[model samples]
Target chain A: MGSYNWNWPILLKEPYFGWIVSGFGKTILIAVFAWAIAFPLGSAIGIARTADNRALRLAGTVYVDIFRNIPLLVQMFLWYFVVPELLPADWGRWVKRDMPYPQFITAVACLGLYTASRVGEQVRSGIEAIPRGQRDAGLAMGLTPTQVYRYVLIPVAYRTIIPPLTSDFLGVFKNSSLALTIGVLELTSQARQIEEYTFAAFEAFTVATVLYCLVTGLVIVIMRIVESRTRIAGTIAVGAQ
Target chain B: MFGSFDFGILLANAPFLWNGMLLTLQLTALAVTGGLLLGVVLAVLRLSPIKPLAWVVEAYVNFLRSMPLILVIFWFYTLVPKLIGRPVSGFYSVLIAFVMFEAAYYSEIIRAGISSVRRGQISAAMALGLTKMQSMRYVILPQAVRNMVPVLLTQSIVMLQDTSLVYVVGLRDFLTSADIVASRDNRPTELYMFVAIVFLVICFSASRLANQLRRRYSL
Candidate 1:
């Protein structure tokens, strides 16, 4: 233990620094792209959960339950390894050999769908928290149920749920590290790579820890700004301490 | 793919998969128990009036919470041996990491639960001439535990699912066992599908139970 040397400089050197930067970029890329899928799909599922149609609600519940219950790592494996195999023989061959950035694509799809379930739950809660009077008022105004959601419920629910959504967004960043399992070579994977290449596990991980904190810190600040700016005047203040 | 699906290999590998599932369950149970115990202590320390001690505990929890659990596992997997001046088993390293990592999350939940107990309960206990420690034990914690149970169950479900991450360090957790058999048997779809179904059933039912408890207690 005493014989272990601390080598911080290697992280700043040529290839290692490049690895860190590229890994950082890939992580952000995966998280943001995944969010693109999650937000819309989750919002739809959330809306369905709150709707009057029994079948729609049941379907939404089924989707949320299945996606939320499975571990993200297993989901990642299934998407990467099993999905391609399940395709038609020629298509499977193409996915296995011809697809561009297969690992990255699988990572984004897996993470996107998984986080969608969580976002759906948050959206459901947000909508449920709205007063009964709000819905009744929309009905009295002769707005159809769909119109009521489109014009009234969704806008308010989305705003009210921003805080929880922000956390889920952060979850995506943290969860993006799992992409390393399927060889997407994101930030955590790169840190492990550096550790393997040089036995300076402490130094490599320390740098990774700092980088993760910086990204999360930046996200928190940005979300705080968004929260303040979009805060509706009379809505229930969540997390009001 | 469905027509060619191999059921026989899965039947042959059932014992192996079951053993892996057992290991996964064992890890989840140990981590949840250990994490909750450590978390309660952290929550108490953070809530205590000792400014320096509270500050230190807060920093530790926040730092751990900010990073990914996988990174924590890897760091401790590498760091513990150095600390002990000898190599340790992968299971021990992962156990240490899960307990510590989960403590941060569980502590926050416990802290919230404790805070949700009304301030008047403490005052009432004080008016009854009980000591602060006595008040906490007799008055506050019982109510806090009631509120905390449902959320704690939910968190444990999360940790149970997270136990699959043990595969990263090559420990043969449930998912890893399925993975091994899938690759060996060339039946990734069947094996992985079975793993997903197993996780879905356990976690979904657990969550439903959590929801029922929440409703029962809220009344």
Candidate 2:
């Protein structure tokens, strides 16, 4: 494992150190925004999936299938290039011309949509796992269907699904690195940049890899704490995957 | 732009794209087979009684899983040649990276499959005079594999989509070939769209097969 000079000190020097830290921050920012987008959108679609209306169910399924099937890179490119061009002329011009943080927005949207599909699956299975009587009891208590979902079904489902959702959260964090391909200059791209500049490929990547593990490990620990606290007694078997 | 769409660029470059797709399939096959072999070995070690060996394997798996696949490809691409004291092709470098990274995931799948085989089955086999390794080989893995077929297929689909990431290593995978044509003909839209369509079609079919497997296995 040690053929080259292992200069661990290089990462602490002025430019490389700042570059890596900023990249780490960007990566975290992307993950947070992506989760912000995925969670609510996924929850809505997940609710639609369990709805009695046939059209809503089909719409949810189609959204999941289309977004889930395409490779994330392709989706990123599509959002950045094809989608903007597909808009009306003035709007397209605005996207390609005057839009602020175009790459950032596109990457966030692509990641959010892509990750929403996976989260939606978790949500669907979670809602389905609740006892049928829960829905009936909510309705029997003079609540509307939406209120039943909001008050009874969704809350329970979300609690039971914390663990799986945690994995999905970690997954989105990892996938955000793919934003580098679209020229987002996130953590992985920063590693490549450092490698190109200093030829310290091993050191640069090792540092970045450690940073990634640190972030993900922290997420796992936090999620486990949340999971332990929210765990419902005797109802743990619901969507346990 | 819609009225001026031109797939002539894609049509002429069809053979090149086909070659790229073949290369992708070749890579996927090699990685899945090689990774599964390595996965079986790792899974066995993980299931073993030795704590330190299991810990080492766990760390390796968890670390790789935590990092992005693209980073792993880059890491191996830059470091492997240095370690081996010679130059290597992009294909070999990417292949090694894929095999190593996918092995972590496959080992997890295999380990879960192995664990699903009941404790009694292993104990019963031991009582019948089979060694631990022999019992796992003869009695446990066979049933575990049957239960695990669907998940393996699902993971393979994921691997297939991930093959496109090899483009970063300068490997002309399905997406890369399209990018080449797009640049050559000055038609990014048509060519990239074509690549996306091809990916969608292939991935959708594979996902359908996986869904079928899920239904069958759940039954």
* lDDT of the candidates, in the order given: 0.91, 0.87
Could you say which candidate leads in DockQ?
1
Query: Candidate 2: which docking quality band?
Result: medium
Chain B TM-score for all candidates, comma-separated: 0.96, 0.92
B20-101: candidate 2 lDDT, tens digit per residue: 9899999999999999999989998987889999999999999899999999999989878887889988899899999999
Q: Give the least accurate 10-residue stretch of model 2 chain A, judged by summed lDDT.
A: A232-241
Which regions in candidate 2 have their CA more than 4 angstroms from the true location? A1-3, A140-142, A236-241, B120-139
Which CAPRI tier for candidate 1?
A: medium
Provide TM-scores for the models: 0.96, 0.94
lDDT of 1 at B134: 98
Query: lDDT tens digits, residues A1-241, model 1?
Result: 7888988899999799999999999999999999999999999899899999999999999999999899999899899988887889999999899989999999999999999999999999989988979999999999999889988888888888887898898899889999999998999999999999987789889988998888888887888788888889975567521
What clash pairs does model 2 have? none
